[model samples]
Target: MHLFSALAVISVTVLQAAAHGYVPLLRINGKDVPGWDISKDPYTTPQPLRVVRGTKLDSGFISDVTSPDITCSIGNQKLPPGPIQATVAAGGTVQVLWNTWPLGHFGPVLNYLAKCPSSDCSTFKGDTGAPWFKFQQDVFSNGVWASDTLARNNYTYNVRIPSNIAPGSYLLRHENLALHAASSQGGAQFYPGTFILTPVSPTTPFTELSLVCIQLTVTGGGSLNPSGLSFPGVYKATDPGILFNVYRGDAANQVIL
Candidate 1:
């Protein structure tokens, strides 16, 4: 079976949300690893053990498609737990936990994998070049859109590591694009917005954040580096995928992946 395809199509389903959300926890092989704790990490000296590459604050996002923050999240360069942690077998699932998701903001959920050069993720920055490979994508259908994932699964979006990829240390990038306000240039959230979450059939426009990364090590997989796409170079502000009316229809053929 294609590892990521099953869970990748699913997204977070939330209710009673406010503005936006962020990644704060991850489940690797069933173990709940604390992501960057936006609420307590800053104040707590000797910061607690965090597994995922975390942003400074919780429940935030980015609107600029050209910004490097789109690669991961702001202030999310690198973090401790270095020398490899958060290991998962190939074909396993890592649950990305979004603290809060706006009921209005809706779009496709995506996941990428960039194997750290030299097998060390601490020094490798994933912002530039085409090192990031699109492995796990959502709703590859017509008119289907951002999903009701979290509400059904306890606020966690499940990302299954592709079984065919090589085993090594990788930076797992998780993102949810909010295209509710994307009718104009630069309004889409690579990093939040409004819209319907149900999957619509036939005609419609398509779509950001809830962008975050985790330093992950994959074991028991084949050897292969998939071709990748750059972040800032991936989505253009004017591109139909980024600029379009969600209520009307999608530009990327309504293919929410």
Candidate 2:
């Protein structure tokens, strides 16, 4: 009887695996490290996007929502946390896709949190600061928690890669101010992890070999800028190991642009 049960379980597991067909998944919890990249195309004046070598990219979101649909909402979300590794030649327009998640889960507190530290509510931090004052305002200043995120499954935004971005590698950070929370008590409160983006590239399409990996990190720290705080500056990787250092341009004749 026990053997039969075990066989039955194995059969079910195989069936489930077959049904899913080994779908590709991206994690949001800072584990399961992953990456991707882009390359240059020579056919047109404006280059076509190509996957560069040795590049890793990461994506993330701010809310605590764990529903299947909620998790799906984060898939391919744009800007900081989403994929942004496409190549454009000199003086070309680069179109990008950015996804936004629903906002209802955050409730009425959204307005207040959006403009936090405005001499109104208190703030705090997540992994560092105290509880009561863990959150601040400037954190979400870069983003407008518009209404659409609260309504649908997918929110898309179109953007152009600036021509002036140069040819060097860059990192994009998407911060979703999920909520406010304190550490212990009367300590501090800050937002939660939302989204992140990393850029990597190797050699150009014409070059021999190039590798690039994009790294993205999302944190709860806002613009509370203290006198002695150690911020590597916003959009910068706090640690060198997590840094996305995908070099651009040709291999032998590469320019740090």
Candidate 3:
């Protein structure tokens, strides 16, 4: 009887842990940045908006691209600005760390950045209205994205910041689409993510005061595509990026845009 009780407890614990997955930590240039930590209830933090969790859409609005929940899932509330900010230079890399990832949930990993109206991005609210640009996206390579690579190996994903992005404060959004069960409509699992503050500045070349003016902007002349698509607007129910069959092993045909 005791053994059966222990087994039941173990099952419940596992289920509870797998109930949700989120990026609890973020790193820039190999150093940890101030971000959400799901281990401590994110709701209690100053940046509650940075704690939105994923939803199980096996039977619900998984295929509904027009739904507001499609942006970051339902029940996700916006909070006041966070006290911390991630300072990054254009053309640098940022690493995202997930708390836990379930096995077999394979699909693409996408990143977007939305410039804030003012210098303080922490004051931004809601998932819509803010036009976001697709700065970084990884599609099916070798029949899989970061899902299999991150789940089986490392839980951290390194993404490069756009080299052409103008210096400003913006909100960085990341997502993981689990398509293991996406063979049919509404079978896909959407893990919409929390938004973090990203303040971009030019990378200084030298510490000398005389060189400061010359390095006021990113060295490279590259420019980010100004045209952007809204989250709910960027995706459609029939769009190839949204609806795909990963199990068929035809990753080369997968849609990335």
Best by lDDT: 1
Question: What is the number of backbone collisions in each predicted candidate, taken in the order shown?
Answer: 18, 61, 0
lDDT tens per residue, model 2, 45-119: 443222211111222322221222121122222222332333333233222122223443221111001111222
Model 2 ranges with Cα > 4 A deviation:
1-85, 89-100, 105-144, 147-153, 179-231, 234-257
Model 3 RMSD in Å is: 15.8
RMSD of each: 7.2, 23.1, 15.8
Candidates in order, TM-scores: namely 0.75, 0.25, 0.67
Q: Which stretches of candidate 3 lie over 4 Å from their true place?
A: 1-20, 43-64, 73-77, 126-130, 186-225
lDDT of 1: 0.60
Best by TM-score: 1
Residues 1-257, model 1: lDDT tens digits: 22122332102212212245656677776788877656556467675655566454432445555677667655556344444458888899998877776555556677888888877776667888878777877743443454444534565788989888889888887777666655544233332211222223323333544566678889998877785577666766565555556676444354333
> By lDDT, highest first, what's the ranking?
1, 3, 2
Model 1: lowest-lDDT 10 consecutive positions: 8-17
